[model samples]
Target chain A: MTRLLGWILRYGIAALFVVAAVFPLAWMAVAGFKAKTEVVATPFQFFPEVWRWDNYTQLLADESFLRSLGVTFAGAVLFAALSLTVNALGAYAFARLDFAFKRILWVVVITTMFIPGIAIMLTSFVVVTQLGMLDTLAVLVIPGAASGMQVFFLRQYYLGVPVALEEAAQLDGAGPWRIFTRIFVPLSKGAFVVVGATSFLAFWNAYVWPVLTITDPELFQVQQYLATFRSDRASEMGLLMAGSTLAALPVIVLFLIFQRQIIAGVRITGLK
Target chain B: MAVTTLRAPARDTRSRGRPAGRGRRRETKAALIMLAPLLILLGIFVIWPLLHAVYISFYTWSFYEAPVFVGLENYLTVLTDQEFVDSVVRGLAFTAMVVPAQVAVAFLFANLVKSVSRKTAAVLKVTIYIPAVISEVIAAIVFSLIYAYRGGILNWFLGLLGREDTAWLGETSTALPAVAVPAIWIGMGVASLIMLAGLLDIPEAYYECASLDGAGPWTKMFKITLPLMKNIILFLLVTGFAASLQFLVLPLIMTQGGPVDSTTLPNLFIFRHFTNDLYIGYSIAAALLLFAVLGAVSALIFRLVRSEKAVDG
Candidate 1:
């Protein structure tokens, strides 16, 4: 009975996850094949009587959806690159450099972790607007390019890298740049991968700043567009679901590929 | 190891500026050089914006009017406003309701995951974490479909049992909790992952002894697990509180913070004021207040967690 109970509990939790995780996607998928009447009909059917391929066709025909996808993709990729570069160097400094006020500076940076991003977003908007970057992808990625959590996590991982490797490169009379490029960069690939994964996921999924900064529908990232689309009930539910499914596709792929690194990074960052 | 140490081999080396210190200076310079771009980025992105935000919070301004310094008046108005008060009350209530539910469910799920084989654990982990990866807006859309008034998948499933269709999102009573359903759904996976990490940190020796002493799984869990996982629990409590306090997107998308502002959170209120120009000063004031509350809560959590860690140690 005890063994049976344990088995039941294990399957129970697994079922919970499976249901919770896949149901939304499943609903989206099922609903994509559903018509408007079938979508709102009483005694909801999981499967539609008629598979409407027109939903996909209609969504594909929408220029706004395509543009939003392009904008989101570009912003996410650029932000990921910019954040990764900044985090890599900053983390290297904290881990290896003998700088004045190192501990104080580190504390300052890490404390920013506790300050919620939304609090600073208003100021970010003002600055971005002043700089004439509003309604552009630069505004989307530039203000949030550096994150304290990313820097701190990278620093932790960088500490695990052998310090002697850098010393050896220096012995060859390598310039600081050369030493960093040759010795540290290659060795810290794991940290880079982890940081890059988190950065990408964050940038891709960002909604608030994108909504605030970009007033032009042409500049709307996938999340913002999908949100606005969902808000309008007149828009076909199937097409909206299809777009949402498409928006999630890249991150889902990224997660599958780098699940270990991403999970480890999340766990480490969340510890603080 | 000795060979690798040549790059900057000084463990106890004090200053690298003098005759022997040249190498230290070089390494330090390199470190600064590497870190320069990041500092510039952080200064532009994080620090400057934060200072600007605080500055703007003190002023009465919208996009239309030039910002006028209102000092503490904006704050006073925000604090005394009935709507603001109601929003804060509702936000706290939601946090109070949701945090315990998410944490408990997550712990249960994590323990279940640990019992399975590595392969099954991986599959479960992927499934659970999928929601965590999806954007909040997308998750809201997904749930909106599930909680649709008449034709939602959930209501359809319920219809098999001869239950009447329920308007999950349309009703004031069900709206906030209904929105929270997705928030908790996505949150459960992240929470479970955190708890699993804590579970792994537990030493095997404690579990072995409990089993040898004839403790069943329940006894072992209570006696050995929860005590060992206290720090982990506290960590979740603090961060979860901080994150949930900013709950805006789910409610914004699902109910627009309504069925009569029943679901309007503090952050959504801030969003509303900031966007509309009418409440710019008031919004800033609300945001600052939210920030102050969050700061106080986090500090309290920090002190509590530290004390607990010390006691456990």
Candidate 2:
């Protein structure tokens, strides 16, 4: 009896966890396919009554939603590409090159990782405004182009590269840049993908900075655009749910593709 | 060793061709070129703003007129304000609630998943981790539906159980806890993944030895597992606490720090001062104070971990 009880207890908890983790999202997806009246019906509908496809169509037809989607896609691609290049170069230098103040510079960068972004919000905004970057895509792409954590992770990956490869390149009269491009870059594709995907997801889902910086609706990112649905049209559950689902679709797709790399990256950094 | 032999001749030729000082200068120049973009961005976006935040904390400004210097007044105002004090208390309360709940649940789930079959474990891991991939804004919106008083799923379940439905997000008493639920849920997946990695790192021999010594699962876990996973737990704790202190998006979207300022975190408080009241200096001052508190707490946790390591060593 005790053995049976323990088995039940163990799997029971696991079942509860799985349900809790996934049910809300599934329910939200269902609600996105729900009609307006069916969503707020007296007895909450577990699934949509008719599976209305018009919710998505209507959301897609909205200019603000389309604009936000375009802005988010463009900004994420630019931010990810720029940050990957910058972080990779910096990581390579830290990992393989000998330079003055290298250790001190790295420590300084790492220390800023702990300072919460809210603490610097006012000054960052002021600087952006002063530079006339506010309400522009540059506001989203430039400031976050050099993440300390990304550089640190990529440096860790680069350190694991065989030094003998670079040595061989040197024998062929290759310079540091050549060895970096020819050897390290190709070998560290996994690290680059991990960092790039993670950075893109962060930029795409960014809420606080974009909300504070961008006042014009045309320039709003997806999360900020979704927030307007909440504040302005709280009664429109179907529209809101559809918008939320659409906003989340890109990252969800990316996560499915890059889940292993993302998890391994987190583990390596966490363990360190 | 063969590569080292090859590198010796290359090193010799390079040194013979170029003076050591010139080589060093070239290496430094290349490194500087590579590092310039990162350094410049960090200087302008991170380091400068940090210093500028401290400077602006002492001045009164609203982003329109020139910032008038009012040394220490904004700090005094922030320090003395009852609402600011309440926000800090709420923030601490949220962190205190979330960090332990998240870490404990994560540890539990990690262990449970580890006991399962390999394929089942993989599926469970992905299912649990899916939430972490979703944005905080969407997570908040999903839970707002769950907590909705009229047609909420939670209330719907309550109705099935013949219980009265409560306004989870609308009540002052329940609002903070309601907000914390999603925070804990969203953070669980990453923390558990870290814990799972730590668990897998432990040698199987230790558990086998424990079982040979007539140890039960509980005994083995407490004696073998938890002690070995101390560093991972500390990592989760410090990062989770720092994140909870800056909790804004969920509460802002779900409750707007509402009902009676119950869910008003420090970040939300700072945001309100800057945007609604236009007290930029005061807002910056409050944020700086929060930063100091988080830094001190993190230092304390690190010190504790270090001392534990010393004891172990």
Candidate 3:
């Protein structure tokens, strides 16, 4: 009886998760294939009698949607690479290197985690404006370059790494950069993957800053893009759903591929 | 405990070097050099903006106008504003609702997932975590359709129970809670994963002893699991509160903080105010107010929950 109850408990929660996670995604997929009138019809149809693939076709046909997709793609890719590179370098420093204000600097960096994103948003906007980066991808990427949380997470994991590995490299006449590149970087691949996944997700889901910074429909990222398109053309529910489905696809793909590493990263980073 | 083991080798390495003191100093300086870029970046971006934001909160400025010294006016205005006050209250309530629900569900899910096969657990976690990674806009749109009155999937399912279609987003009563459900859903996967980590950290000896003493899973969880996971739980409480307080996208994209602004969270309230030039300073003031509330709550939690061991930090 106890064993049976345990099985039920596990399966029950699993079923709830399936319903919560999969159903909406499935409904969105079905909605993407839905017709205009059928979408707003009196009763919801679990499966649409007609699979309107034209919804995707029509959505793809839109110059704005296509442009926004291009904007989102370019912005996300750039944002990920820049954030990942900057964070990695910063993390390396905090992890391996000792500076004049090493303890103080790490404390200060970690302290920034307490600074709410909205608090600094106005100044960041001002900074971007002064740098003449307003309404551009530079504004999007540059302000978001320094992730304090990433630095702290990376530094914590790096603390677990043995110093002798790098010392051994130094003994073999490896320079600082070479030691970092060959030894530190290769050894911290797990941390790197976690940080990369986080940066990707952060940049991809960014909405407020993008909405404020970019006004041109052509330059909007995915969330902003969807909001603009939906608000402008609510009549095309089918097309909007299609656009939303596409917007959701990449992150889902990433989550599926990096589930274990990402979960491990969450274990480290979440507590921190 | 691990510190002694780590330091002993470093001490030995120090003794083997000629002119060890100067050599160590030189290496330390080299480490500082490699660390320069990060230090500079943090100073300029994190520290500077933080202080600047507080400074700006005291001034009256639109992007067009030079900021005028407003003294306490901005703060007073934000305090007195009806909409701002309401939104802050609503935000707090939302956090109160979402945090506990998320923590509980996450714990339950983590417990369930632990016993499953590794492959099954991976599949389950990936499935669950998909919502967390999904962009708020897409999820909002999807949920909007699900909660839509006429032809929405949820109401369609409800119709099978012979109940009339009820408006999920259309009604003021259901609007805020409607928005919060998804917030909790997105949060659950992350929370569960965090709890699972904490659960994994617990030594098997405690559980084994508890079971030998005739403790069931319930007692074991309360006595063994909960106490051991306290730090992780506290961390979740702080982070979860922050995330819930700052939630804007769902309400913004889905409800537009509508049905009489019943769902207008503080973040969305601030965002809307900033977007409209007439009330920009007021929005900043409200935002600062929110910052204070969150900071206070966090400090309170830290104070209340801190163990004797945590006092050093």
Candidate 4:
């Protein structure tokens, strides 16, 4: 009886959480194939009576959404690469190299990690306007280029890397940059992917910052355009689901591929 | 711990160098080269803006108008504005509800995931974290449909049990809690993952000993797990509070802070004041107020934690 109780206790909560997590995602995917009537039906049809593949085709037909999708994809890719490169270099300095003010610099980086960006957003907007970056992709990607949180996480990973390897490289006459690019970076692939892929997902899903900065229809991102489309076609659950399903796929697929590494990295680092 | 371990070996390498001063200079040069990009970017984008906002808070500058210095007027205006005050209160209320629910559910889920087989644990962990990977936009949209009045999923399920359709997001009283559900759902995934990391850090030998002493799972959790995971729990509480306080996406997309502004959060309130009113200084003032509060709380927590074991610089 005790064994049975333990089994039930463990599996019951696991099953409940799985259903809760997967339900909306599964519903979104399934409902994208649904007819407009079936999606909003009173009884909440468990399955679509007729699979409407055209729901996707119709959504793709929208010029603005397609443009926004392309823009957001390119922007996220760039943002991820930009932040990863800049932050990794900084992390390497903090983790591997000794220099004047090293401790002070680490303190500075750690201190700024907790400062919320939105609290200074109004003035940041002013600064962006002064630099004439408004409505440009540069504004979207550049502001987040040197995020302290990224540097902090990367530094934690770099600390665990064997210093003996860098010393061996030093004995062989490899400079910091050469050793970093050729040896340190390649060996730290797990950390890099976790940082890069997660940052990519974050940039792709970014809503408020883009909304505040970008106004050009040409440069409007996925979240911005989808929001516009949402307000415009509020009652069109079928189209909205189709759009959301399509928008959500790349990230979900990416997350699945990197699932183990991401979870393992978080556990090892033990920091957000 | 990381600082000392990372630096000690590098210093040893330097002492074995041909010339100590030159090696030191070279390292400094390399450090500067590598750190320049990040420093320049952060200075222009983050630090400078923060200081400038402090300067702007004392002035009066609507978007179209030139700035006129009026010391403390903007702060006074925000303090006296009932709507702004209410928004701050609402944001705190949301955080109070969200932080605990997230922390508790995360603690429970993490323990349950640990009890399962290795394969099941991995699968369960991934599945639970999947929602967090989904964007807030999609989450809001999906939840909105479920909460919609006519032909909505919630009402549909209710009607199957012979109940009438009720407006979920359409009513003021229900709107905040309605929005809170999605926030919690999306939030739990990350919270549980973080909690799992903490849980995994504890040794199985400790639990085995507890069980040998006649402790059940609940007793083991309270006696052994809770105390060991104190740091993790505290970290989760602080970070969770910050995230919940800054939540704007769900309410922005779902209700637009509507149904009589019942769901207007601090971030949304400041954003709408600037966007709707176009008063830049006032917005800056409101933002500074939030920054000060968060900073003070963080400093207090740091002090409390430091009194236990100091964080090395």
The DockQ leader among the candidates is: 4
lDDT of each: 0.76, 0.83, 0.75, 0.82
DockQ of every model listed? Answer: 0.50, 0.49, 0.45, 0.52
lDDT (10s digit) by residue, model 4, range B1-313 = 0111221223232223332687778888998999999888888887887878888899887767888999999999989989988998999888888889999989988888887999999898899888888888999999998887887888998888898888898898889888888888888877888789778868899988888889987898788899988987897798688789989889999999998999999988888877776668888888888868886676566556544543422
Worst 10 residues of 4 chain B by lDDT: B1-10
> Compared with the true structure, what per-residue lDDT tens digits does model 2 show for residues A112-178?
6666788898789889989999889999999989888788777766766656667777788777789
Please give the TM-score that candidate 4 achieves against the real structure: 0.93
Order of models, best DockQ first: 4, 1, 2, 3
| Candidate 4 positional error at B13, Å | 12
> Across residues B1-313, which tens digit of lDDT does each residue of candidate 1 receive?
0000111223433223222477668767777777788777778777887777777778877776788887888889888899999998888888887888899987877787788889988898878888888889888888887777666767887788888878888888888788777878778777888788779878889989988999988898889899988877877887788778788889998888888998999899888877775646677667877887786677566556556545754
lDDT by residue for model 3 over B209-304, one digit each (tens)?
A: 999999998899889888888877777878798889999899998899999998999988888877776535666677777887776666555445
lDDT of 3 by residue, A185-206 (tens): 7776677777777777888888
Estimate the lDDT of model 2: 0.83
Candidate 3 vs candidate 4: the TM-score winner is 4
Off by over 4 Å in 4: A268-272, B1-19, B299-313
Error of 1 at B240 (Å): 0.7
Best-performing candidate as measured by lDDT: 2
Clashing pairs in 3: none
DockQ for model 4? 0.52
lDDT of 2 at B39: 94
- Better model by DockQ, 1 or 4? 4
The C-alpha stretches of model 3 lying farther than 4 A from their native spots are: A61-63, B1-44, B296-313
